[model samples]
Target: MDLVLDAPERTRRIHRAAARFCAANGWAPLSEVPLPNGRRADILALLPDGSFRIIEVKSCARDFLTDRKWTEYRDFCDALLFAVDADFPQALLPEDVGLICAASMEDWALLRPPPAHPLAPARRRSMLLRYAMLAGLRASAAADPEAGLLARMALRLE
Candidate 1:
């Protein structure tokens, strides 16, 4: 029998694997990052070169097809990548974007590199500021469980 994972689980697996791969490559990966364009990036990473890269995870064909807004993400990052399972169809992905294939939790590869279009200096500065702020906030939250619980409870809608 073939094993299969639900969409959310598969997306999480791909995200984790992508983070592992990115870390090994000297990038700090942050998931569920909000971009200025109002789209949530699956994984926004701080590159060693002081730039940013966004990796979008597609759990299935429908997931990729339904959300074609991935292009808008390029305005906020130096490069864009699509991270998907090993069995995902390569043809469906845009040729200009980079590709990531995650075979296992700790095993993955960047099959292609996206052509770099450097972000404008001013835009980069603004995006970097927001990224640092978000990272610091997340770190503090993780360090303080009581505050985290309180924040979640307070933010929850009735």
Candidate 2:
């Protein structure tokens, strides 16, 4: 029997797999990260070597084809990768980007590794700070939702 998953379920699976992969590889991965260009990355991994990697999750052909902004993420990170379900057509994925086949959180494999293109020192520092702040906010929110809001407001005031 063939099994078909909807977009949201596919996305959740992809994210869970990406998160597991990142943790196992000693990288801290964040979801729905906002970039300075107003683009939000699906998964932004902070590598142990002080580099950043962005993973764009594609659930299906339509999701992959319709996104024109994925290229812009390259400017902000050292590597750009695409995470998709096992059933996704690998040939449809771009050759320039890396690929990961994720069937579930526990069953995912890296099909390709993206070439390293390190960001400039200044941009790297800026991105790192942004990542840190976002992570901190997330942690705070998890601890106390109201405190998290106040913390964000204070940061904005500064």
Maximum-lDDT candidate = 2
Ten-residue region with minimum lDDT total, candidate 1: 149-158
Backbone clash tally (model 1): 0
Candidate 1: tens digits of C-alpha lDDT, residues 30-107: 888878777889898999788989999998899998998898999999999999998788899999999999877988
What C-alpha RMSD separates each model from the true structure? 3.2, 2.1
* lDDT at residue 140 of model 2 (Cα atoms): 84
Best by TM-score: 2
lDDT by residue for model 2 over 6-85, one digit each (tens)?
Answer: 78987888888988888988999999998988899999999989999999998888998898899999999999999988
lDDT of 1: 0.87
lDDT of every model, 2 decimals: 0.87, 0.89
Clashing residue pairs for model 1: none
Q: Which residue runs of candidate 2 sit more than 4 Å off their true CA positions? A: 1-3, 153-158
